[model samples]
Target: MQIILNGAATEVADALTMAELIEQLKLGGRRLAVEVNAELVPRSRFSEHRLAPQDQVEIIHAVGGG
Candidate 1:
């Protein structure tokens, strides 16, 4: 399926959930926040949130600064 990820066009396998997508993208253990279709998806609900075609996915990773 095709989805917009971080403002870029991305194509991923079918029937992927947020959790699966994270793992698929190797984002495990990273401090990040996810927004789908202008809605914030809680970390706990990652496994439950299924992605659909043309969904907007924004993953913001934390950065350290002094």
Candidate 2:
């Protein structure tokens, strides 16, 4: 399956959930935000939100600086 990740074409497994994607990208347990097809997916729903092919995904990580 293919999805547009952060404005770039990317390949991913079919039936992939948001949580799985996060882990695949090595982003699990990090402070982050995810949006799919212009809709925001809450962290609580990451496990349940399944991504579809051609879906637009945006992942933003929170960086700490002081």
Candidate 3:
């Protein structure tokens, strides 16, 4: 399946869940925010949030600043 990830077109496996994508990105231990098709997806729901083809996904990582 194809998806728009962080403003770029990318292909992912069929029936891939948000949690799996996060693991694939190697961000399992990082603080981040995810938005799908302009809708925010809570972290608690990542495991159940399945990604669809052509879905627009935005992943923003949190950075600590002084």
Candidate 4:
């Protein structure tokens, strides 16, 4: 399957969930925010939010520095 990740075309496995995607990207356990097709996906729902082909995904990591 193909999805637009952070504005770039990328290939992923079929029936991939948000949580799995995070792990695949080596981003698990990090503080971040995820938006799919312009809709925000809460962390609690990452495991349940399944991504489909051509889905627009935006992943933003939180950085704390002052």
Best model number under lDDT: 4
Worst 10 residues of 1 by lDDT: 7-16
lDDT of each: 0.93, 0.96, 0.97, 0.98
Query: For residues 1-66, what per-residue lDDT tens digits would candidate 1 score against the true structure?
Result: 999999999999887899999998999889889999999999999999999999999999989899
On residues 1-66, what C-alpha lDDT tens digit does candidate 2 reach at each position?
A: 999999999999999999999999999999998999999999999999999999999999999999
| Between candidates 1 and 3, the TM-score winner | 3
Ranking by TM-score: 4, 3, 2, 1
Model 2, global lDDT: 0.96
lDDT minimum window of 10 residues, candidate 4: 25-34
| Candidate 3 lDDT tens digits, 1-66 | 999999999999998999999999999989999999999999999999999999999999999999
Encode model 4's per-residue lDDT on 1-66: one tens digit a residue: 999999999999999999999999999989999999999999999999999999999999999899
| Candidate 2: Cα lDDT at 62 | 91
In candidate 1, the residue pairs with backbone N, CA or C atoms under 3 Å apart (3 or more residues apart, or in different chains) clash, namely none
| Model 2 steric clash pairs | none
Residue 1: error of model 3 in Å? 0.4
